[model samples]
Target: MSVTAVNDVNFATQIRKEGATLVEFGASWCPPCKVLLPILDELSEQHGEKLRILKVDCDESPATASQFGVMSMPTVIVFHNGEPVEKLIGLRPKSVYENVLAKYS
Candidate 1:
């Protein structure tokens, strides 16, 4: 499936579902977040079997972001077995993302 959008209300349930999860804590208007969308979609297609990708709009889910101590606009957190395993902040090369997800996926 494509990347799923999770909000404040569904964050807990979604992250706890199962398997490896990469969550993008971002805002709609953030340029870096916008850029990451297509990359994430494409990456999801390639890694969907091993990963469940989710996106959360920080603007709409302030409490959720705050809970994660997300001080940046595009904080990507990788969760496996219901616990956070890795985190990446700011923009980076696609290979950088693929490398991280590859490790956990």
Candidate 2:
């Protein structure tokens, strides 16, 4: 499956029960978020079986955004077995993401 979209209602359950998850906190209006989408989508397709990439719209899920202390858009955090393993703030090269996935995937 492609990346999952998360919200406040499903956030906890998803992370706690889903095994492993990578979440991106972003907003539709943010330019960098927009730019990052295609890259993430491509990565998701490239690593479909190895990773579970997810997104949370900060505008729709304020509580989740606050819980993670997401002060910026395009915050990419990788979680394994309900714990965060790595985080990348702002825009980044796709290679960086691929490398991280290779480790935990």
Candidate 3:
């Protein structure tokens, strides 16, 4: 599975879905956010069965970004049962994400 794009309009419904949801708050101009895209894609494919991966462009979805208190590009928040449980700031190694997913999966 590939990471689905989410905007302020649907962000609430998407994250509220059953199971673990990983939301990446970023923008197109952010270099690190660009680099993190492929990693998220890989993660989506690898953990699709156990997790839902979504991306929220900060520039395009400012309201949702602000609601999550995302101050930087590539801020990743892991949500379980509609509540945020863990937050990862900046770009991180794939293993770090895998470790987080393991905790919730």
Give the candidate number with the greatest lDDT.
3
* TM-score for candidate 1: 0.93
lDDT, candidate 2, equals 0.84
Global fold similarity of model 2 (TM-score): 0.89
Once model 3 is optimally superposed onto the true structure by TM-score, how far is the C-alpha of residue 40 displaced, in angstroms? 0.6
lDDT of 2 by residue, 1-105 (tens): 566888999888777344557789999899998888888889878877666778999999999999888999999998987888898999888888888777776
* Per-model TM-score versus the true fold: 0.93, 0.89, 0.96
Candidate 1 lDDT over 1-105, as tens digits, reads: 789999989898887446789999999899999999898999889886788889999989999999889999799998987899898999778899899877776
Q: Best candidate, TM-score-wise?
A: 3
User: Model 3: number of clashes?
Assistant: 0
**For every model in order, what is the number of clashing pairs?**
0, 0, 0
Off by over 4 Å in 2: 16-19
lDDT of 3 by residue, 49-87 (tens): 778899999999999999989998899999998899999
For model 1, state the Cα shift of residue 103 in Å. Answer: 1.5
Clashes of 1: 0
Checking candidate 3 for backbone clashes, the offending pairs are none
